[model samples]
Target: MTTGPSQQATFAGMPTPLYSGSPSRLLAWLDCPRRYRMQYLDRPRPAARAQRAHTSVGIATHNALRDFWDLPLAQRTPAGVAELVRSSWIDVGFRDPEQSAAWRLRVRDAVTDYLRRSDRERQPVGVERSVSLKTEQIAITGRVDRLDDRDGELVVVDYKTGRQVPTDDDARTSLPLALYAVASARMFRRACHRVELHHVPSGTVAVHEHTDDSLSRKVAEAESIAADLRRADAEFAQVGVESPRFEPRPSAICGWCDFRAHCPEGQRMGPEKSDWAGLEPAGYESAAAGTALP
Candidate 1:
């Protein structure tokens, strides 16, 4: 006997569990199906190139920010931030030691300035907190950079170390931020409707206030993406690369594709960028941002 398309998706006795993914995973599919297949489904995944200096900077900045809250109140000073940056720095993926050291000092200052404007006296609700949001269709999990309680309302704050200073529209449209806000609210049993993108380099906070309807809409949007992923993932399991579901979507940003080394179609789009191509000063355009998968 043959099963219907829906029934074929089922295992011996029950339907498959809800799709598990992060906002990044969904975005990866939207960015390029071939990339999603490689990064998520392909066994013996292709090795991505060495990290860029800019990514190192971003990593260091995030680590320093996360560790800062753990320090004793008195040690949360600018000098302390410098110490954390030094301790958490990843020296890989740079032009040279000199370039690495220069960027290190710049990041130190950026974090220091950003923290100066923060209210150290008021402790945050959470830092680098892992939260999950689940619906009947999808189970989403991610780590939020920071969670704040302003006037008893929960806020989701995502730190951006990239060149672009995010705007209000970015905050409004961000799926990850919206999902985090929903998860934080549900986890803490508080109303969380505000999301802020804290652009660390420029110390700018782009804010957006989401309504209940808006958040619900975002979740529905996520569910839609997950449904597609569910089907593609199943197809990949059957035929792998032969799965027409995963297509190569190339663009000029091929220069920044970490998986470009494996994708002939992408390589044909443009020349690969230098390992340090994305290491420009934060004030400069984040080359990665140009083609950054939304």
Candidate 2:
């Protein structure tokens, strides 16, 4: 008597899981593992002020310079770039009107300073170009701010929005710039050994020389990070959301954390949520609605 398979229950019935990856995920891991868990793993909704005014101003400056470089050679003048900045102006997270105005002036001055220091005579070989580098198990993607081929040698140029000028060691250790050099070399079919950090605010250049060994090391580090992410995702799938507890690292910088109010560690540190003064109404309206008024 051939009997068809009887109805039997599967062992520990559970649905499959979901996982996603992004460049910012790796960056968060580098910053703090618990922070990374809260951000990427838990994916909590923010209920507090996230970023500082300086960060906003820096982003605006970087975007302005990027747009300026995107312009045609005829429009590469300082005046043209300033106009671009004004056109693309965003006032999302400023403390107050006065602070916003001061930041705008600072951005304009930085752009002007950058243009003056940059070589107008020599046009960029490439600008705002996106490239990707891949290994057997990892892929790293980013945009190059500027790529210049001077005197038959390739150079990677990155604009710095911070007030302080970085030193040569800082430039050497910068992962993004090194990655750009590696990607640009592969894209252009040339050797890119020189990486530069152009500090617009200080109008100075921090140069670093890269060797094949160093570039290989950076790639290996990135691959290792990717492997860590894969392992984390696998563990999450097996154990579910309750698998790993999300811990928060509270510091003075917690005031700038987007998930500060949601973080137990952050709340226990001090000053629950009184740091939103002078911020734009639009930026804090949601946060205010989520948390009680102070």
What is the TM-score (0 to 1) of candidate 1? 0.91
* Each model's Cα RMSD: 6.1, 11.1
Residue by residue across 1-294, what tens digits does model 1's lDDT show?
Answer: 223222234567675577888999999999999988888888889898888877998999999999989999888887788899999999988889998887888787778877877887778999999999989889999999999999999999999987677999999999999999999999999999999999988778999999999999999999999999988887877777898999989877678888999999999887888878776554532222212111
Per-candidate TM-scores read 0.91, 0.76
Clashing pairs in 2: 95-278
Off by over 4 Å in 1: 1-16, 282-294
Q: After superposition, how far is residue 103 of candidate 1 from its true place, in Å?
A: 0.5
